[model samples]
Target chain A: MSENLIPLEQLQKTCLYDSHVALGAKMSPFAGFMMPIQYDSITVEHNAVRQKVGMFDVSHMGEIFVKGPEAEAFINHIFTNDIRGYEPGKVLYGMMCYPDGGTVDDLLVYREYLANHFLLVVNAANIDKDFDWIQEHAKGFDCKLDNASPRIGQIALQGPEAEKTIIEVLGYKEAADLGFYTFCDVEYNGERLILSRTGYTGEDGFELYTTNENIVEIWDKFLKAGVQPCGLGCRDTLRFEAGLPLYGDELSPEISPVMAGLGMFCKYEKDFIGKETLLDQKAGNLEKKLVGIEIEDKAIPRAGYPVETPEGEEVGVVTTGYHSISLDKSICFALVKKEYSALDTPLCIRIRKKVFPGKVVKKRFYQTNYKK
Target chain B: MSKILDELKYSESHEWVKVEGNIAYVGVTDFAQKEMGDITYVDMPEEGDDVLAGEEFGALESVKASSELISPVSGTVVLVNAELEDAPEKVNEDAYGAWIIKVEMSMPSELDKLMDAAAYKKMIGE
Candidate 1:
């Protein structure tokens, strides 16, 4: 059977299933894995990581290996980032786009040591399609791109106390000084792997990249050293709090970079796909703009819900929302009309049958701890 | 594995109905609360609102998702547990004690359709 048509009932499993169960994680289906949504209360787990230390099993993210002579030019053509400036051990946050300027996937491009090869970490759901897309785009370039997602495991150690936890566990001195977006290859149990100061949560953290064979052992060590196991429930809340957009929500084939407020990542100097259309959209009035909202009422603004002004005029729709622990208020991201995008502009959300009052707020609902 | 009091009746949706004269106290069974993790918000019916039997009166929102609070015995809502407005997690902590709403029954015979504690457990595969 084709991968996309596989029934939801025939879902795949992650490597940490048994460990999550042992830690009392509330397991649920997310992006096709029976992953942990939370161990304790979602608020408690969320606050714990924001204040102290927490670790997440993010192995579900897809990682692809792109190498060979034409790797540099080929990757630069597909991604929005200018890859020429990237040095060995440096990583770049970029989005892969279709010829029409629609986002295929947002990914982290890691430059490997002493080579033009790059490691592209992508969203799990878009693995197969992304691989095919890259292969199709490799027309005249003498480059080899391989799907290495299934063979790798990724663990994120995040939060304010992340540095302390890392030093204590691995005895790696000066690891904290490795600036954001920089990584180093280190030996773990005699196995060489990469450790990058990167995370989804808006906190000081490091992501351990290793082969699938060594993942279980590394996870066990982290657990033994008291890394609180976090799940997807808090993961969603944390990213929302940080004002990070989910792929299916803030990005899709229908939305352009200008409307999504991610035009800064698009390089104007480069001749790549979809430049003309994006430039046109950027030059004109944006029909919809992503804005952060805070609900004064008890209603939670979920996706596909209609957003309206207090006068009951249809403005836009909510992309994602829930009871945000960091804000201590109901928060949501909505793509509203430019007129209603100003900060503190009052609006109303239609959740189910009830209409609740809300206001547009500045992005980053909670202060992020990303290294400056 | 909880002690189900006989006076309370249960619904297939795992809500409990405690009858006191023509009024009934409605809450979720311990089994239901355990399944819905960390209740964040309880959308309860307001006073004077008429509810139908086996219909959704309100919903209990959890950190992950929301589940409907189905009425076992329909009636006019006399009062909602005001305490839940401030501490919705109380439902997850103690389901039976944290009755979501109280209703004045329009048809008292609606209680007859519910299952007692023993039958409710059997329905839950307990």
Candidate 2:
């Protein structure tokens, strides 16, 4: 069920590990954790999140807390998004880039507690590296940094019926009032729970974060409520269909936000790291650009497959490709040269000695149903 | 547990062979089809092509990944399953029924080395 064959003892398990096992989930290593890839089938799970509702054990995601008088300034210095005037309950999505304009990580910043406090949710695999990187840049800041990932657990209840499920099953009354990308702190069993109308699946949903002790019970209630148990496999498909970027695939150290067409999220008026480089990129100084392509045939284009022009000259490689479950067509994200990045541009993807024709299209392959 | 047919012979690479006279019908076993979810495409060798035993003759593309389809018995391809060219999901529906190719065996004696239904089941830990 796993690829790398890491020592079983070394793989970390989530709070709902036993529950996943008992449900006969196909477990695989993901971000150093024994994560469920699927419970029944990838097709079934992917359709559930797109058509109905599904829940993901997103506990492996990193949660870092920043506090102190210098919190806002320090975060603004490192973050691409300007959070200086952010309201306490506001949430912002952006990236932390290196000085050379390479991506460090894309993250979400949530301000909920006080004027000087914020929660940074990051990818699980980069927890240690991100913490150290943030700490290194935080040498002169007076803010206190806490890597609270090990103590926190999260669940993303997603679909059109998310609010109803959260109300009827989990009984979180605040879900009905929360706006997209916004969260409210709720007290459950004397423990603070952060419930937000945020999701990666491009659906109307809510993400709840709480202590590890509270997560298992919350998961049980969802399980008993018959919420479809989704895994990382479908989570990927749903997010891909939504045009949401995955860190490792879409954004990496070499693939900057501007290159990935995410420059809109980067506020350039501030003095953040990599601001100058990104600004230069925005002014037509970029080379390879990420674009969406639709394959004209049944051949599936996969990552690392060379994308070529009509003359067979290699342009770039596929970053992520799939037979989109919702659209019922073959589409992929590729980083091709600027000349071939425009819509309706013709490109070819070579899969195992066979070159398939494709055309560039909008990145958002499926219409999202996010509740405003 | 995966299904096993008494009339079919199996290879360790998870392919099944149904012999009819000198022709061997080749397809992926139930275990292989189930493990590879949602077959999307099937790359097959053209008719009259020589297929070597234990060599990759084609590929099975699924939603998750593309897996190589190894030939269990070496022979010249008699016919390619044209139906799978557009309807690859037939394998997911019925692995044994969805024969990928029919080969006129160059070495029909090679069938003696393959495992029957009982031995194949034991080998797959069914």
Candidate that scores best on DockQ = 1
Which residue pairs in candidate 1 have backbone atoms (N, alpha carbon, C) closer than 3 angstroms, thus clashing? none
Model 1 chain A: worst 10 consecutive residues (lDDT sum): A1-10
- State the lDDT of candidate 1 residue by residue for A213-328, as single tens digits: 67788788888998888888888888888888788888877676666778888887886676767777778745778888888866578888899999999999999898887776
Instruction: Please give each candidate's TM-score.
Output: 0.95, 0.96
For residue A223, model 1's alpha carbon misses the true position, in angstroms, by: 0.5
- Lowest-scoring 10 consecutive residues by lDDT in candidate 1 chain B? B1-10
DockQ of each: 0.62, 0.61
Q: Highest lDDT: give the candidate number.
A: 2
User: In model 1, what is chain B's TM-score?
Assistant: 0.95
Off by over 4 Å in 1: A1-10
lDDT of 1: 0.83
TM accuracy, model 2: 0.96
Clashing pairs in 2: none
Docking class of 2: medium
Off by over 4 Å in 2: A1-6, B48-50, B107-113
